[model samples]
Target: MLPRGRRRARGPRPHLLPADARHPTGRGRADGRAGLPRRRHAAAAGRGSAPRGGRAGARAAGPRSREGRRRRAVSDFARVASAADVPAGAARVVNVGGRSIALCHVEGDAIYAIDNVCTHDDGPLGDGTLHADRVECPLHGALFD
Candidate 1:
């Protein structure tokens, strides 16, 4: 006499990767062992296509390293939010021209914008704490004003 209820399935399970991923690539990640095949990036897959960050400026080669580049004023500015969106003592992160910018509302009627990357460790500054007119990096205790 035996009493049995629900039983677990004793079979193979499906995973996210395909079966071909098991092939060796003569290298491994973080160790000197076998590694999976590397996938080609879409931007560099074709010869007829442009490169990833688009072509650099035509005059961006050879010189005193571009004091003249500043002659071209930035003519494009994207509006991320209005004054009311970021209240006082608050910070908002916005992407402008593929760069992360932190908009901080300080005191009243004044808004400051800075790159949302910490200089010390490249941490996200927008996710950090806001104090008066400075931002503290979340990863470390680095502060920016």
Candidate 2:
């Protein structure tokens, strides 16, 4: 049996050298034959960056691109009609901040706010038909009720 701190004799330990360390000169094997490292170089050449495609490279470059920053800064809210304006058992389309909101009057005199756009498409929920609790998308007749 092996010692408590030692593992069983299991062949050679796996090589943990970095890619650059494995190829100090960034070249192939000594025999002038192409090796795995050469294949990696060819793959990199084909894919461009280390992350592979354009999307992968962008992801590796970190978060919050310029456009994303601009979007975050832009206010998307719009003030819709008042709570008293909405009737019971119905919904009203109101522009709040800068976004369209589907103001729904559910049971217990509660107001529910949902995106005016339908999940099926970009159809405006405000122009759609409203049932007891949900609104149906008017474009394709997709029911959200």
Candidate 3:
């Protein structure tokens, strides 16, 4: 037997999936072996469905394809507060789309908006210190631009 922290050596993994496993048609099991023929979902199934000629084809579709920069450019901005509401070098948490956003105003009279949750551990970013153009999360001191 090996020591408590040591791992046991194992042989090469099996290449074939179990024949009876249930998954989308033609998809492989956890073993990476194809169990059955893969099936295609309806076009209206949205994002989860394969895009046209599959993932490889989507890469060649360019930025003009759906879900690209063109789709992101359609966002319309709504005024959350007056410029003076957030003084220079200050930040305020604004609730939008059911999520808290940290609206920051820096020295250059420039305003920036970012998620209020820290990427580190979902800590509230609005409660953190506002530096020049970054916000430091209070819980972990993780910096976000």
Q: For each candidate in turn, give its C-alpha RMSD to the true structure in angstroms.
A: 14.2, 14.5, 9.4
What are the per-residue Cα lDDT tens digits for candidate 3 across 1-145?
7536697557754535454554555454434544443556644345454565557355544456454653334455767888888888889999886878889897789989999998779998888888889988999888999
lDDT against the true structure, per candidate, is 0.72, 0.68, 0.74
Position 131, candidate 2: lDDT: 69
**Which digits, one per residue and each the tens of the lDDT, describe model 1 over residues 3-36?**
2556555575554444445444523333332343
Alpha-carbon lDDT of model 1: 0.72
lDDT ranking from best candidate downward: 3, 1, 2
Query: Which runs in model 2 stand beyond 4 Å of their true positions?
Result: 1-79
What is the alpha-carbon lDDT of model 2 when measured against the actual structure?
A: 0.68
Off by over 4 Å in 3: 1-75
Best TM-score goes to which candidate?
3
Q: Write the per-residue lDDT of candidate 2 for residues 1-145, one digit (tens) a residue.
A: 7647787767855566545445557455433443334455644567555554346455555557667642333454445677789887677887766778888886778877888998878998877776666777889988775
Each candidate: how many clashes?
0, 8, 5
TM-score to true structure, per model: 0.47, 0.40, 0.50
